[model samples]
Target: MHPINLNEPATTRPTLAESLSFTCQLGECRSELLPLLSEVSKVVSGEGSLSKTLKLVLELMQKHLQVTRAMISLYDASCDQIFIHESFGLTKDEIEKGVYYPGEGITGKVVETRQPIIVPVIADEPLFLNRTGSWDKTVDCRLSFICVPIMRGMKVMGTIGVERLYNNRQLLYLDLEVLAIIATTIAQAVELHLLERAHKQVLQAQSARLDKELKEKFKPANIIGNSKAMQSVYRMIDKVSHARTTVLILGESGVGKERVASAIHYNSSCGGGPFVKFNCASLPESVIESELFGHEKGAFTGAAARRAGRFEEADGGTIFLDEVGELSLSAQAKLLRVIQERCFERLGSNESIKVNVRILAATHCDLTAMVAKGTFREDLFYRLNVFPITIPPLRERGNDILILAEHFNAWFAKEQQADVPAISTPALNLMLNYDWPGNVRELENMMERAVLLAEEGVIHSYHLPAALQPAVLGELGEQSGLEARLSMMEYELIVEALARFQGNMSRAAAQLGLTRRMLGLRMAKYQLNYKDYRCGD
Candidate 1:
């Protein structure tokens, strides 16, 4: 296909149909139109995507028709302009320059009026703007431009246009008819493409919302405690979770020290990375070094293959050392080195392996005493204790015992596929009286036993273990007379229920299995004002 030389002097040229008639017969225009439309139909209805189908449609127009260039422009509501969506025989720079406002040029006029336009000679028509630089504007050019609005019903979507060399006005009108037919086919394909793009945007929005919900479920605030002591712990967790600080969690055994460490790790910036846990007291001193610092093959008597330690496994994440004070002095020195340099050499290998990790250590022992006695290194102790958080024992966490008991009861009942039973007043009194030496761990185990042993839908005092029976209650309870003990127990239960409900009388009565009148009478007998337990407003 030769390009029309726009720089040539104005001269007489044969019409397009006259040129074709010299090569072929006279009545062959319908035969040419039929095959071109059929090829365009096959390209439009193909299983290819919108972008691919549009590209082939433009290319087919240039190939089967005697046109120098073909293009499909689409209306962009975002910018309120018509821009060339796809084109053939035009460079990328030229295509970028093909933009027009509504009714600005021949293509824009077709879009605005929703009609086809034919320019018998481009140089003679001032509306045929050569904005794409496909031809020289300073010379007489015998090029014809035909543009048809791509429409759906009465609305115009955009325009499909072509540039050709034609001298006869009758042949230019015929070219306009061919462009109109192709524009109709393109309209259907463009409609489907818009629908698919809208559906994809909806799916992307839904996926983002679900991702946010899942992240909220694992946040530190989901630990489930409303006590003032626990609130302080939550504040500490929130502060440390945003940094790379080494944290030392101090708490008694069974006080959920590991749980606090887990909360910090999951809420941190590196929450997506691995979280590796190791128990320093679980292994013997002889193999503790090999376990903390990965050992190479044949490093020890029983060592068979190379292995990665918890520190190496926790690269770009966090490592939790439980009972950290139990680490041997030799292992402590190696841990101190890793904390200082962020690198460590495996046992039996001199090659140092670098790691990027945050350390979180927990211990129930007195690290200061151990450091003074030379059992634990002072340098290592200081490194691990940069940010210390102590979780209070369950006995010290006032009303949280009842909250935790209810949570564990519901959890275990779900696990066993049994109905959740209500803890009776007698059983509640026994729990509040006893001192939980084993902390939350002891309460959790007791609740599991109580839930399993409970008959019907109520957990009575007899359903609890022997340690929580009347004989044990007598030793921990008021030790006054029987009536006095009952009255004091009644007062304590009312106060706890009101505090838990934040002075909501209705909910407090529901939890205590009493009516509004009965709860009010009890509150009066104890001289308790519900307003005293009200928080905020």
Candidate 2:
């Protein structure tokens, strides 16, 4: 009989049950096939892994149907090819060779047509390409091939194929009938495997994207300064960011201590964990302990329920205590215990709770002075001072004033939905001469106020705060003469040049279009020190 091909139009193709009539006439009763189908169903639907369950199904087919070899090939949509995923009675090397594009061989044809195919005699069928080499036709020429599409509803997922000794056309039809039912059972397991793999890939992609965003946000470059002092701070931040060492951030108030703490936290090994921030100076002495270490219910007059402290909230992460020197001696002692033992007792709670937390503390006050004054604990100061980073006051940062002003101008402009205004010459000179005792935070606030007032798209001297205006300087009895202003501007230009060149006087003078002698005379006039602008300053 010609090789059976059910690769016809859906309406014309006979159903698999109707095709089994020939097997019934050949004495392979349909009732007898129920046991084999039941066994395959149990194996495929079992709780084992996909690969193991599919492997067992193939072995069952070989044992019950007298099949010589069998394989379950899965469709890889990415490559548009089918590869053997599980097999029985085939060597590993043979399975490696069993890859086929759609419609390339018997297995590929079954996948493409979404139908069954029966090759009565392998030696006579040119389409039986034996790509796997397991079926050597020269040695065994009496083998028959049966392949059926493994489908999920109307969609074809892959194919399953079997090889058996050629008995007659009736028995070949019987083998086809048995294998088709097994392919149906295998489809559910394959679909679930594909879905699980897709879900894992999505999660992995999201994690990678978030990690990249965090790295970009915390890079030292985002701090927005190129002056020698700020560069030194950047180097320090980079060095301590990957360790668990306690860091003492020493800077004047409003110097962006919290910003620096965040940079270290997001770049450290605990980057993905929570970052809890508490200002030690913001709370009063009466409730500071409860705020730090949670109080039990009814522990105090206002304590209504149990609460988690900052340390407990920061478990497996970091806690940033701004103005740590402001904490009372009692709180300081508790903090010291947490730092040394990684454990502490909550307020009014006798039981000590443990945690894993990295501590980062900041203060504008001198801890050594506080310790000397008998206010701050000396041991806590030593514990918190493992690594110290000092951010320079804004006045010493030279042209970083201009850089930060421009950044804040553009940023606030976008935030307030206004045009980014230009900084007029007088405004630039005024900003250069201001002491900026409030540091970067003062500069940010001034720029925001200036952006609001510079409605004409240009920031003039009058748009700045009274602290940076000439009229205000005159009212405050500060120098405001044109000669004094010119001298200040000249001194600022010299400082910017020196800072940019790392205090190389020759380069700094060349950049200013002046001789080294003239540059030194001007620096001497303003009492500006070049050594202070050096790299390690």
Candidate 3:
């Protein structure tokens, strides 16, 4: 079986796409696959910045493939060693301790053997690499792993690597195949990464480097956070970026859910893929369907040309529907059918247009409550919620408040080309104290305003909106005690790391630099259960 056969006879083996939704559902997995392969050619020619490309690639792996992490370790042909060239979600300690290496580990063994190996449980795998004599100090408790040789023709480039979850359940054969696909894609991309670097060097040496000017297309940029909450978002993105799953992003207004959606599509296995976006709330009933699914020429009064809809235009890539909660019942039903079947008909045309689109949706409204109220269809909710991710409101994410404020300050300063200025102590305190009802979005707007208004070298409290800057020093007294708030903040940050790392206490601890036991005790104290919150849709 091709592993993509949608319908399988009961006696015959079930197809790989049978369990997976996108390949079979879209009826054009080949179309999707070839495009991504072709995209590598474009990626090679695009740039020579290894870090930017690798960072973007790793981020995409998180979004598209649903894999916890991805790596492109290469065989240093000259040095006869494996270089842990690029990775995401791996800690500094792990990478240094031969996480993926020729330094006495499984990857090294795989390179030595020139064959792929599957360890359903890392614990049970033979002792090939023992950088650490035993598992006593290794942060990697992730036992389910697969290492495939990155071969260029018959020559092995390096080892393409993947792990299921941290300390996860045993890896099934099916999971092995999944890892193989990831390895195949990554091996190809990494090879291109190397070729790109070489070509970039050639261009730079010749002074023939092309000027890369990116137009400000108003696609969301700089949705920054490395805190536990954002890490959780990064993980969820890792899980579903490449797959054709229906993703539902839930968050309050200004939580940057749309930005997150864009990240998912751009970082998924389809990072090079086209991204088509529609604000469902902005359009009326008659236009919404036509705009999203497309309309034929003369289908509507002003429909002069046969235009491809967002779904078709985003073929082999992603289509993001923002504010999907606002969709009318009839529209919701049609959306549900399209999501379920991956086929739609243009207005005034009975012929079905099949598109290879990965669907990502975001809404500030609570779909569960809406479903309960009969405003949203339960079926649509179920389809979209196959993978559901929630972005925490600003108030809930602890000191990320300050971190994001700093990020926005820098970004807005550059955007508006205001000479960069530091925030005054009073201004910083005001921002940290305010409960951002609009989350990151609100903070960004406030920073933009402050940067514009500040005539002096520093942003002061007086420049902030009246709601944020109160004259009375006593206003701070009305909120929770600072000590108590900091304690809760510390507690939440710990829990977020645990969840973000998929309960890998060691990696989570590395991110926080706390002992695994220390992190656990805090979890026990706070009574936090964050297992489901870590990995994304």
Judging by lDDT against the true structure, name the best candidate. 2
lDDT of 1: 0.76
Report every candidate's CA lDDT: 0.76, 0.79, 0.65
Model 3 residue 152 CA deviation (Å) reads 68
Model 2 misplaced regions, further than 4 Å: 1-221, 471-537
- TM-score, predicted candidate 3 vs. hidden true structure: 0.47
46-76 per-residue lDDT for model 3 (tens digits): 5334455556555554554445555667776
* True-vs-predicted CA distance for residue 34, candidate 3, Å: 81
Which stretches of model 3 miss by more than 4 angstroms? 1-222, 471-537
Clash count for candidate 2 is 0
Candidate 3: residue 178 Cα off by (Å)? 78
Q: Which stretches of candidate 1 lie over 4 Å from their true place?
A: 1-222, 469-537
Per-residue alpha-carbon lDDT of model 2 for 1-537, expressed as tens digits?
223543444455445566555445654544446677888898875555677788888777766777788899988765688999999889999999999999899888888888788887888888888899898867779888888888875667788888877656556666776787788788766754554444335434654564465454334645766666876887789889999999999999888899899999998999899999999989898888888888899888988999989999999999999999889888999899999999988877899999999999999998898899999988999999999999999999887787788789899999998867666544665787799999999999999999898764556565667666545233432556677656644654666567556789998787667899999998886666788677767
TM-score of candidate 1 against the unseen true structure: 0.49
Q: Which stretch of 10 consecutive residues in model 3 shows the poorest summed lDDT?
A: 209-218
- TM-score pick, better of 1 and 3: 1
